[model samples]
Target: MITLDSASNNNTAMEELEELFIEELMDLLNGIPELTVIFSADESAAELKEYAEALQSDPVGKSRQIVAACRASGQRRADVKQIIVDGNRKFLWQPGGTLRVVQLLRDCETRWSSTYLMSDRLLELYPAVQCFLNHPQQTQIAHLLFTTPQYQLLHDIQTILAVPHAAQELLSAEKTPTLSAALPAFEILLESWIDLQTKLPMLSHYIGVGIVKIQEYAAKGRKTRAYALAMSIVILCGVTFIS
Candidate 1:
């Protein structure tokens, strides 16, 4: 069994290894006729990470601008953190304080979930971010402040990315990683993106693209016996538990 990421080099390596296993090793070890090599890729991680990178490069929308603004804001995390904390403190001492202070999150280039987290935190602290940037002393980064429409676009981007982000997190469970979870996660992501296409017309193009990418990966995953067997075992366990 071989597991790899969806890189071109890895794909090439898998193909060559499979050929070796079939043409050379199979004959050499003819006694082990039932033996076979299982080649699997981390489709969930690949899809989410590639989708984020592709979205950032898309020319059709303000996603790139929104990400850039968030990245710029993160560059001044200390100042933003102080602003949010002070604002929260003001409400804390008030009669009916309901505000919770949230620090601005910075996205890592390699992780799609971080991008979602940063965008989510930014949207959550929108008012505080605006106030911080609007201050006279903060004029340097004032230009990085998001406009009303840009904020809406940012929200849309966040919404679109949420499905895959959640799927990635679920599949990345530290204690109970299971292949049975992959197909369902892909299905959920496909359903969410298709639904988003209808709900967010402005992002229909990107969402449509995402739907196709997920479908492609899902189809590939369905061909794997390990995935099928894992899902079957999960179903059996569920039935037993219910009974």
Candidate 2:
């Protein structure tokens, strides 16, 4: 075992000896990439490439902005929350209405899963929200509510992100896992994405770009694995011959 703590080595002779070992170890690993580099390569190769920038990206951010602007921007005096509550309450009490009232869920910056929940809730409450904004009492928030195109954008985003959000939740469990679990999960995701290509053209384009980058990294991983297997076989053969 080696100790690198400066305070633990008070002896002058030992300090000089430790410096020599440190220098030799550094020279020995001079060409090796750091852990951060290896981790980044793995991220770029895996499904992580799909959501690496999701926190700051437009789909999640823009959806949040649209909802927030309803209460804070444009005419600015409307109690958007009260309007939604009243509208949903009215709808729930209406004849032939059996569904429970659902409130809009805001996305929290620290919780990534909230983005998907927010979009899903917005879509579910769309009709009620539209009704509230259109009513005479909701003058201020009407213009602030998302326009037709903006709502469409949010819907598409929510639909596409559902897959990743579900996968994230499934993967985040604390249970012990194996490498074999990843391929099936990724295959399912890829198949679902391929089916959504026509339904979500914009999302398809973004996914296509990420797929290209991931493919390049995956090719590199394959070559590395092949080389390692070959080296292992050669080493085993030599060891057997020596024995």
Candidate 3:
């Protein structure tokens, strides 16, 4: 079985490979009747990445605005970084305290997780950000400052994306990784989004989009015999161990 990311080029390549496998390789593989080639996508990682990009690309999205404002100018970036450094010094001066200062992260288009990391860091240094924005010399960019409600929205975004992020990490683990974890991860993602929809009504649109994407991938995964067989093996192992 071959697993590929959900890229247009990868999709095209998979299709071509499938056609080749059926037309030319099938006859050759006929001697090995039990052997089969299965092509699977990196389910959770792709879905979560796409979901993050969607949030950032939405024209009306506050996430997009916040990111844009932060990245608007090099000077502004430097200022924010300086503020964080200064804040770290003060924090470390306190008795029995250690500095945990992190530079503000900028998101990259190629890696979706960067968006989450960026938001996480921005929220972490929010006080420094406010101080920078409210500075007398920084008045020109003062309009870029996020409101309390906007910051809260960003917090909500962080909370909502954490579920899928953890699932992606689990599926992509380097140690004793199993594809058998895929279905459970997807189910957890779907349930998490569904629950978030009710709890964060203001974010229903984003949550709805996430739910649909999860369902689509889950359905495609369920249709594959390998998925079912893997899940069955896990269940049987559990039952045997219990017995």
Candidate 4:
């Protein structure tokens, strides 16, 4: 359900924007280059007006200041990037397993990824955080959140359950019992991270709860359908035997 929109205002607007991908399970959206800001001009209008007036007076200075900040401390290409997502404005570290994928998500946006949890102010500042977890490559990682309804998370955890054991075999000093499998251990780490994040109440919501209930109903329906099919098969077999 997430769609990536273009943030470009003109021919020169696209740089990293071209890196966006719309893979099977991912949705991303871009915003206008500069005008997406949600300004609160209510009581603060006087000060806000003053600030804009200053910017208007010295637009070149404002540009230079931003450029200076980036050049002075540019870490955009690093494996780990910090970004504000929604209202929480959480500091970020790439999940160790998928740093490259993290970078892609960190710079992207998705409408369906639920940035509503983020405040407008935070979103305004870092519009790319919402889709960070939804990139196709990180889809499996995102499912690691217990609040998610999808089974891919558990499936992914199961996939990596033997990583520690594998690591043990690789170690020299008497590779004892392989420690543990690497994959599931990684899943455990992911689970812990996500669980800790949700506990922060500010980011907690009923979405996962609702998804779980939906899954339960779907499971029940499948079971009921299977039972009916089995009954129909038995009846047909008996009738054929009589013939």
Q: What lDDT tens digits, residue by residue, belong to model 2 across residues 68-119? A: 7554543432444555556556665344443334446676545545656876
In Å, residue 41's CA in model 3 sits off its true spot by 49
Across 186-222, the per-residue lDDT of candidate 4 in tens digits comes to: 3443454356346432112222332343345434545
The lDDT of each candidate is 0.57, 0.50, 0.59, 0.29
Least lDDT summed over 10 consecutive residues: which range in candidate 2? 1-10
User: TM-scores of the models, in the given order?
Assistant: 0.61, 0.52, 0.59, 0.18
The positional error of residue 31 in candidate 2, measured at the CA in angstroms, is 43
Cα lDDT tens digits for candidate 3, 1-243: 112232233323222322332334234334444432321244543443333343333312444455566567887777777776777777732443423455566655555455666677777666777777789986876776765544665677678767866776677677533567787778877788888889986456656766776788878998999877876787777732221
Which runs of model 4 end up more than 4 angstroms from their true locations?
1-200, 227-243
The number of the candidate with the highest lDDT is 3
- RMSD to truth, every model: 16.2, 18.9, 16.3, 20.1
lDDT of 2 at 144: 48
- lDDT tens digits, residue span 196-222, model 1: 999986456656756776788888999
Clashing pairs in 1: none
lDDT of 1: 0.57
Give per-residue lDDT, candidate 3, residue 53: 40
Backbone clash total, candidate 3: 0
Query: For candidate 1, which ten residues in a row score worst on lDDT?
Result: 1-10
